[model samples]
Structure formats: structure tokens, C-alpha cells
Target: MISGVTLLDYRERYSTKVYFQKRFFTVYIPFLFWSIFILFYSLILGRISISDLSFASIIDGIINSKFLSFYWFFMPLFAIYLSIPIISLIPKNKRKTIFEYIIGVFFVFNSFLPLVFNLLKIPYNSSLYIPVLGGYIIWIFIGYYLDRFDLNNKSRKIIYILGILGLLLQIVGTWFFSYQNGYVDQMFKGYNNLPSWLYSSAFFLFIKENYHKLNFKGILSKLISLCEKETFGVYLIQYYLMEFFILVLHFDPYSISYRLGASVLIFFLSVFIVKILHKIPIIQKLC
Candidate 1:
């Protein structure tokens, strides 16, 4: 929603090409620089030798390897940004209909296509397509639509009810699916799931409704403002920060308390690191 608001305002103030170009630079340049840093850092740390640093290997690390597991987020986000110009050219009245159809198709693909492939014994690779067609794209359109149109009170209440139900569905479905799959991981609760779609819609609506009620002032407000500013940096660096606690400090991954504490520690550490990084001119753009 925030991105939607900002992009819409930019569209009003600037040419479409200029806005698209600026948005591309702000995100992609940072991503490319970060990926390059990862490659060099791996070389320096002896994780990869000159022979292993082939063009294909470097590209795979940036695009698919577990060394940069979190970078998958950047790929779909970039795809969404790339689609903005095309979506903008779409007629306003037709956008919701088109988005609904696309999301519905992809949602089914994410949730059921794998099962169908398994049943048919077809060798299908989800990784090849899920990032581009997954349900996260639905939320991007939702954000844009919500920014463009307000929900009526009745609609909000209905969404709130559905959200609660969705949360329940997610919790129950996780347990059920885990048992059926003979694994403990809640893989069914992926970002592309129906439960996530419902829950996220509800959660966002709840926040939107309640946001103005809370008096955000003094230290609390300032802290929130800082977090908002540092969020992209936190996202960029958080995987490594969290991993340090697990790898170096040897925090037990199975312990909820340890994981929670590590998260809190990483959050503050990431914020501080981002603050310092922000002071530098070129690096500032990435953070």
C-alpha cells in the first residue's frame, strides 16, 4: 500500500518513463551491487576459488543458490516493478478484472499444480516459474487497488471476518499438511497460499482501519519512523545477521525463545549497521 501511494504520487508528478527508470535504479542497482559484493566476499573468505567463480556460478548464486536464499524476494519484486508500465497502460476499469483472473490462475498453479504434476509423475520444476507467477504478485495488485479505492464499512467488516478465518485455516492447514506430507515443516503456509492471501488482506485492512486511532508521538513515533526508513536495509542484510547468531553463537534453532531473542538482536544490529551505511553516498542508495 505504501509503495502504491508513493508510486501513484510519482506518476502524478513525473513522466511514466522517468518514474519507471528511477524506480528501477533504486532497487536493481542496489541488488546488483549487493550480489557483486557477495561474490567478492565469498572469494575473499575462501568459500569460492577463482576457478569456481565462473559467470554461470556467479549468476546462479545471485539467482538461485542457498548462499543468497533471501535474494529470491528481490527477483519477484523486480518483476512487479517491470510490470508497472504495462499495468499502467491497462484501462482503469479493466485492471481489477484482469488482476483477478491472473491471480486466480496463479493461485491455483501454486496450490494445486504441484499436486497434479506429482499425480501424473511429470518432472516439473516449481522454482522455474513460481517466483514469476506466485501469489505475491496478487498482493502487489491489491496494494495498488487499495491505494486507489477505499473499502466501505461493510466490506471492511466482511474482510476482517474472512481474515480471522484465514488465520485459523493457515494454522490448521499447516498441521494437517505437515502430517500428510510426513514432514514437520509448514510448507503449505507459503506466501502463495490461499490462507496467506486472506490473512494478509485482512491484516492490512485492520491496520488501515486502526492506524489513525493510535497516537504515535514522542520516542515511539521516532523509532517507528526510523524502522520505516531502515526497512529495506534490514531486509537486505537480515539473513546474514540472523545466521551469525545461529552459526557463531550456536543458538538452538529448535528453541522458540532462542530464535525470538536472536531476531530481536539482529533487528537492532541491522538497524545500527544500516544507519552507518546510510551515511555513505553510494552505499546509501542500496541501504
Candidate 2:
């Protein structure tokens, strides 16, 4: 197999010199930038807002709220994107496949579950903490599968077909189950829209396989490269900044379009901030 901008190989993790693998950088970078606007808009507009206080209410509200329902969906994907690099930091001896690293990340976050369960005064499922952590677990694995398309062409074709079929089945199943009430009351609602997991999974798999074969090393590639490199800083500040903006704009988050716009604005802002902070000795850790 051809070496893709050799960095810290899984077999030889944590080398003296740090380098980004070409496999991940180009695709991840552009996707991250695109996600900011897409996810934010969905959050603010796609689903209804989480009512808090009850796990049931949040799930229900998310299903009802256009933007809020979408927010729950984003949690799984974006959280995973945020965590990949951190997981890569683990020693090679201790780590195995990217899936193992993802589990480790989940366990690290899951460690806090006992505390969250005890401290939070709410009904069952009121504690939505574990799911967010689980989201990280899901994405990193997706990245691994994406970066290394070892699967044969036939296998990939089959997988894509199955993913689509599974989603279609899921839609039918959910629709049937949802008739119990006037509406479905779970954050895990809707389908055939932007950021569809089944479609994204298929697309990522397809890209991973053909990425090297494609023309990705040009100006557009460099632009994406920057986003991938700056993503950690972007992740660190995005949600915090989003919250801040919510207060500043005095705008209710239920507006999906505004939140989407804010996410796009924040994506560029994060890159500029990272450039400045890289100069500072101490603040680097915060980003």
C-alpha cells in the first residue's frame, strides 16, 4: 500500500516529529468547515428546543422542534470529530485499532457517569451525558474506516447498499412506532435530510477508497488542510462561543438559520483565533 504522507503510524504511534496524514487531513478539513454551517442551522432550526428537566421532554421536544431535533443529530458526529486527535495521543502499545481508541475515549468520559447520575436531580434518561460521550466513540471509528479503505470494491458497494436499506427500514419502523402518539418523541427522529448518517457513512466510505486516486493536492486541498489542522482549536471554542452568541444576540436558539449562520461565522473566527494563540506559550492548551 502507498504511504499517505507518513505521520505517526498506528504501529509506530507517537514519533519525535508530528505530521498529519494526507488521508485524513484533506477530507476532514473541508467537511469540518461545511459542517459548521450545516450543523448550526439544523440545531437552531431543524428540531424543537430541548425543554430540559426531563429526559423524556428533551427527546420529545427535539423531535418536535425543527432545529433542536437536528441538534441531537449533530452531537454524535461533531463530538466524534472533536475527539479523534486526542485519542491518537494514546501510546501505541496501549492502543490497537481506532475502534479500541474510541472505546477508551468513551470509557474516559463514561467515568464521569457515576457522578452525573448521582448529582443530577432528574428522572431516568434526564442525564443525557453518556450519549454525547458515545457520539465521540462513533465518529472516531467512522474516521478510521474512512481513512483506510481496505475493503474491496465489492464489499464497499454491498455496505453502501445495506446502509441505505437499513435507513429505509428504520424510517418505516419509526413511522409505524410513532403513530402511538401524534408525533415521534425522540431526538433520534427524521431522515432523508442533510447530515443523514446513512448517507454520510456511505459518502465517507466512498471518499476514503478513492481519495488517493483523486486529484486532491491543489489549492482546494490546502484550504481543507488548514481547516483540519485548526479543528481542535475550533472544537474547543465552538460550543462555548455558540452559547455566548446565544446570550449576546438575545436571539432564541429555536431559529435554525441564525444558529447555522453563527456556526459559519464561528468557523472562520476559530481559525483566526488559533493563529493568534499559537504565538502565545500558555494559551495553546486551551485551544
Candidate 3:
């Protein structure tokens, strides 16, 4: 028979392992859910409103916007807005060839963008993609460390504090110092400019604090999981739907309310659209 002390130790070890597994999903689920909503809108621009039709025109638009941007400052997320979710899919321990990793990072960073800038007449911030994707990748590495390594409380606290502080600095740099010209004001430069580091830090901590309390089983849980899965589909296509609203409603998308309205309304509608598309065989690939 097992000794009492050994049995208790085994039980504690098992509990800790179980908790780590749950925490991993907790961080991922919320990030993925929001990424879907943003991705839908990005795709709409690429699919429906593309007018420039050339890579040079897109680059020209970026330069032109910086100099003589006559349009009101409006920031809509690009599909790379889903970076946080995308990185979650990168397996932590999977090693890559040097060339493959470089290509992987490059491809991940530019997934929905090169097409958008090349095709769409719209010109937004150009360089903001770096920190958005970079910060997310960094967070994934951080998440891996927190989960995979044996870190003492002191080490965790130091990392947590430094991460928070660095993020604050990045936010300050984006808002008051660097980053401008209407590229998703959520990034390093724009109105309410904040760095990806700041945003990701807040997101990471928010899930860490709330994951346990969230019911991961039940009807609502399933609903949220569905939402998370739909993020990319919703993100890529929602903006196309919004373009419909833009043309028909004559809504001044420059206004904050309009953007938020676009984001909110597009989310559920895309969710419904995704569900319907899933039922069809041929269109499932598009979704």
C-alpha cells in the first residue's frame, strides 16, 4: 500500500498539472474570440473596397496619406489584428529551420496586409504591424515560459512588473511620441495610440485573473468557444459587410460611434454568416 505522505504528494502534483492545462486554454479562448471579430472587418476592406489595385499605389497611398491625408482619421483593424490569436496556434516546442522560422514570422506578420495595401485604395499606417505582431509573439514566448519552466514567485513577479512597466513606456511612446497617421489608432501611432506590448500585457493579465472564475463548461461556454473559432472568419469578412453599411447608410465611419457600431454589429452578423456558411459544403473553404 502507498504511504499517506506519498499519496498526498502525488495528488498535489496531479492537481497542479491539471490547473496548468486549464490555464493554457483560458488565456487562449478570450484572445481568439476577439481576434475573430476584428479579422472580419479587415477582410471586407481587402475583398470589397480594393480600388488601388497595385502594390505601388498602396505604398503611394501610405506616403500620400502621411503628407496630405485629407480624409478624416479613421482606424479600422487589419486582419493581422488577429495576431494574438494566430500566435496562439504556433506550437511552443516546435523547432523550425532557420529559414522556415524567418519565413514563418514574416508570413505571419503580413498575412492579410500585403494584399490589402496592394489592392485597397485605403491607406493606413504602414510600420505599426511590427510591434503588433512582434508583441504578440513575445507574449506567446512569455506564456510558454510561465507554463513550461519552473519559475519561483520572485521570478514571476519580476517578469510581471517589468512587462507592465515596459508596456507603459511603449504606450507613452506611441501616444505622445511616436506613431501617427491613422493606422488603427490602437497601434503605436494614432488617436489613443498605444503599443501592442501594452495591449497584450493587459490582455494576458486579464485572462489570468478571470479564467478560473469563467465557466468553461455549459451552453455559454460552448457559445464563447464558437465565437473564438469564428474570429478569423469573422475578421476577414465583416468589413465587407460593413462596406455595405458604409455605402448604404452613408455613415461617417470617421466618427467613434460609427466605428464601434461597425465593430459591434458586424460581430454578430458575421457570426451568423459564418454559421450559415459552415452548413454549405463549397463555401466552407472560404470561411
Candidate 4:
């Protein structure tokens, strides 16, 4: 949804060159800086040995985002940013049809087909390949589509119902499979799955539709604005804060209260740290 807003903003206001430059400075540079910082932190914590630190290894880490596992999201996000020039070329008149077709193709091959194959115990041989329509890219198109078009009351109602069903399927199916298998199962929890897509889309639509109704004032508004501004930095540094909580503070992972408390504490701490970092001229841009 954020990416969709970005794409919309870019297409409506900025040139491709300008967008690319802004993305480079704001996103790419910060990603690079944070990846390296994580790498150094890992080394200090003995998660990685000094002997493993070489120029080639560092380059590999940056490219693969090995410093933090979830940081792999950056590669796809970067690719999406790079493809913006081509994606933005879709003429306004045909965008609705084209985007719908693209999203449909993606849903079938990437989500539905895989689920079908897995259920039927059929090995996928890659017989029919639709390379252009798959993965996180689908979300970008979905985001753009949702942003560009408005759904009627009937359509919104149907989508909301399906989304609720999707959410139930995700939660119940995972629990059932896990219980049967005597282990945790993540089969239904992937973002690329049908359930995830439906749930996410519905949630995005709900927020978009109702955003104006939510009016915050005074300290609450200021705090929300501050957190929003520092979100990127918080995301970048959150892993370390989590590690600090778990390893240093010895927070009980199994305790629900501890988990909830830790989450709130980590978020505020990360925001505070990022806010402080922003005050330093040299470090501000990197974050």
C-alpha cells in the first residue's frame, strides 16, 4: 500500500529521473548504511567472526542482505523502484484493464496454481512460465490498481467477506496442519498465498476508505507524526533492539506479557534512537 502511494505520487508529480534520484538517496543509501551497521553489530556480538569479514564477503552480504534475514525485502523493493520507469509507461486510459489482467495472471500462476499443485501432490515442472507476473511484483500492481480505482459498495462488501474468510483459513488451516504434523506449519502463512493477498487487500482498502474518519489531535497527532517520520529508521534498527531485549535484558519470549511489553519498549526505544540519530547531520541522510 505504501509502495502504491509512492507510485501514484511519482506518476502524478515527479519525473522518472527525479524519482530515481530521490529513491537512491532516501532508500538505497539508507539500506546500504543499515546493512553494514547490522553486519558490524553481528561481528561485535560474535554472530560472525572477524575472519569472515572480507571485501568480497561484505559485498556478498550487502547484495544478499545476509546481515539481517528479513532485509532480503530490500532487493525486491529496489527492483520495483528500478522498474517504475517501465511500469509508469502504462497509459492512463488502458491502465485499469492492463493492471487487472496482470494481477489476475499473477494470482493464478503465483498463488492459486501453487496451492492447487501442492494439494494434489503434483510436482511443478515449470511447463508454463509467466516470468513477468509473479512474486512481490504483483503487490505493486495491486497497490497501483487499488489506488487508481474505486470499488462500489457491493464490490467492497464482497471483498470484505472474502478477506474475513481468507483470514480464518490462514489461522485455522495453519493450526490444523501444525497439530496434525506435530510441528509448526507455515504453509498458509506466506505473503504470496491467496489468503494473504485477500486479507492484505481488504485491510488496505478498509484503511484507505476510513482514513479520513480517524482524526487525531494535539499530542497524539504529534506522536503519530513523529513515529511515521522515524519508521524507516526504526525498521532498520529494530533487530538490534530486539536482540538487546532478548539477550541482554533477558526478556521471557514465552511470556505473553513480556512479549507485549518488549514490543512496546523496543518500538519507543528504536524511535528515540532514530530521532537522536536524525539530529546528527552526517547520519541523518543515511537513516
Maximum-TM-score candidate: 4
Model 1 weakest 10-residue run by lDDT: 1-10
**Least well predicted 10-residue stretch by lDDT in candidate 3:** 1-10
List the candidate numbers ranked by lDDT, top first. Answer: 4, 1, 2, 3
Report the error of model 2 at residue 64, Å: 27
lDDT of 2 by residue, 1-287 (tens): 11211332443664332334432444345333434444455456644333432665534444443322323444444444345456557665554464555444443444333333433633335354455445335444444545643667786787698567656655665577577656873322333221244555676676656666664566556767778667766754566566667877665676876667777887788887877876887655444
lDDT of 1 at 108: 67
Off by over 4 Å in 3: 1-140, 147-152, 155-172, 178-195, 214-220
Q: What TM-score number comes out for model 4? A: 0.92
Whole-model lDDT per candidate: 0.71, 0.51, 0.47, 0.82
- The lDDT of model 2 is 0.51
Model 2 RMSD vs true structure: 12.9
Q: Candidate 3 on 45-94: residue-level lDDT in tens?
A: 45424553366644454334321232112112212223334433445345
Instruction: Tell me which of candidates 1 and 4 scores higher on lDDT.
Output: 4
Q: In candidate 4, which residue pairs get closer than 3 Å at backbone N, Cα or C atoms, i.e. clash?
A: none
Q: How many residue pairs clash in each candidate at the backbone level?
A: 0, 15, 11, 0
| All candidates: CA RMSD (Å) | 4.2, 12.9, 14.6, 2.0
Q: What lDDT, from 0 to 1, does candidate 1 have?
A: 0.71
